[model samples]
Target: MNAFTRQLPKLMLALTALQLSAPALAQVKAPADSSNQVVVPQVDRRDVRLPRFPSNDFEAGLFGGAFSTQNFGASAVGGLRVGYHITEDWFVEAALGRTTVSDEAFTRVLPGGIFTPGNEKLQYANLSAAVNLLPGEVFFGRDNAKPSSVFLIGGVGTTKFNGQRQQGFNLGVGMKVFLRDWAAVRIDMRDHIFSVDLLGKRETTHNLELSTGVSFFF
Candidate 1:
């Protein structure tokens, strides 16, 4: 054979080796493409905040005004109240009130008055549920304003007067204005109905009470 024939087989073997390694070289280099590579981005994050609300569900207060005993005329009355808010529209309260009713008017016309001298003290206690009927704002000036609400309330209680204990029912309407988030000013009008033995007769009487006071919430 000539030299060209002798080199042909070696050239064929080198070509076969290159063909076998082609796939391995392509697999190593294919991942270098930008589309095939996974790129991680560096990022900075910010904090997020939310709003807050207030919850003041319990309240206590003191009040003073006039109590009009059915026949004894109106007298100065003072009271205190403790309450719990059931919801934004409803609440329950327990109250105690005291006043003195004079029998001076009856004494002038009769020898013996309806009540004795020491028995003129009148006191009452009640547990009541109230509903907010009108909730609004009260403005004092251009820059001052207060939150206010009008409510209807009624409940059963006990009234003691002239050394007698009697079951009573009371109904009232009230308005309250918030002087601060923790304090408020309130005005109320109530009528207490009860039975009492006066001048040898058992009579059902309606005693009207009007009061204003300040309250605190917790």
Candidate 2:
């Protein structure tokens, strides 16, 4: 009986140890599962904005206005301008045009005492540099929008009439109303300062012009 009792206690101790060791093994496997599990962070993308495109390039247009000269009479002036963009805000423009001026209708007595009427016509061509005070996008708007822009121009060129030539300076301000991405209508006002020699005497003339035209860009 004593031997059986001692053996039974030994068996109980072994079973208890086995129960404790089994829980420790389960704890090890639990940590292994936790290590294998992954937590991934979700990411979100944001929209990026880009800079606007510039309008520096080639352009062409036609313009007309009224003009008066010292030697010539008052007339209508018409011209065409071809321009190249030198920078984002500057351009070089060349123009070729003609002005037809008429003399004031006054009764003039000739050496033979006969009444006569006099008339005169003159033509001119000019070149100029223009500075854009606003960006092209501001004038033409975004890729699919409409806007308005203003510009100032100054230039020096020559005018020829009836085998006579005069040098002059042109100062102007213009506004462009953009109708589309590559087209606009423009209006401009200018003052021309010129000098001429009449009968061996020098004379100064100031001519004012108001003009409207179509501007095309590529």
Q: Pick the candidate with the highest TM-score.
A: 1
Could you tell me the lDDT of residue 115 within candidate 2?
A: 18
Task: Indicate the worst ten consecutive residues by lDDT in candidate 2.
Answer: 107-116
Question: How well is each residue in 19-85 modelled by candidate 1, as lDDT tens digits?
Answer: 9999988878434567777868788777979777667899999999999999789999999999999
Give the per-residue Cα lDDT of candidate 2 at 204: 74
Runs of candidate 2 with Cα error greater than 4 angstroms are 1-56, 70-73, 105-118, 134-145
Candidate 1: segments with Cα more than 4 A from true spot = 1-54
The count of residue-pair clashes in candidate 1 stands at: 0
On the 0 to 100 scale, the lDDT of residue 113 in model 1 is: 72
For model 1, the local distance difference test gives 0.93
Candidate 2 TM-score over all chains jointly:
0.63
lDDT of each: 0.93, 0.74
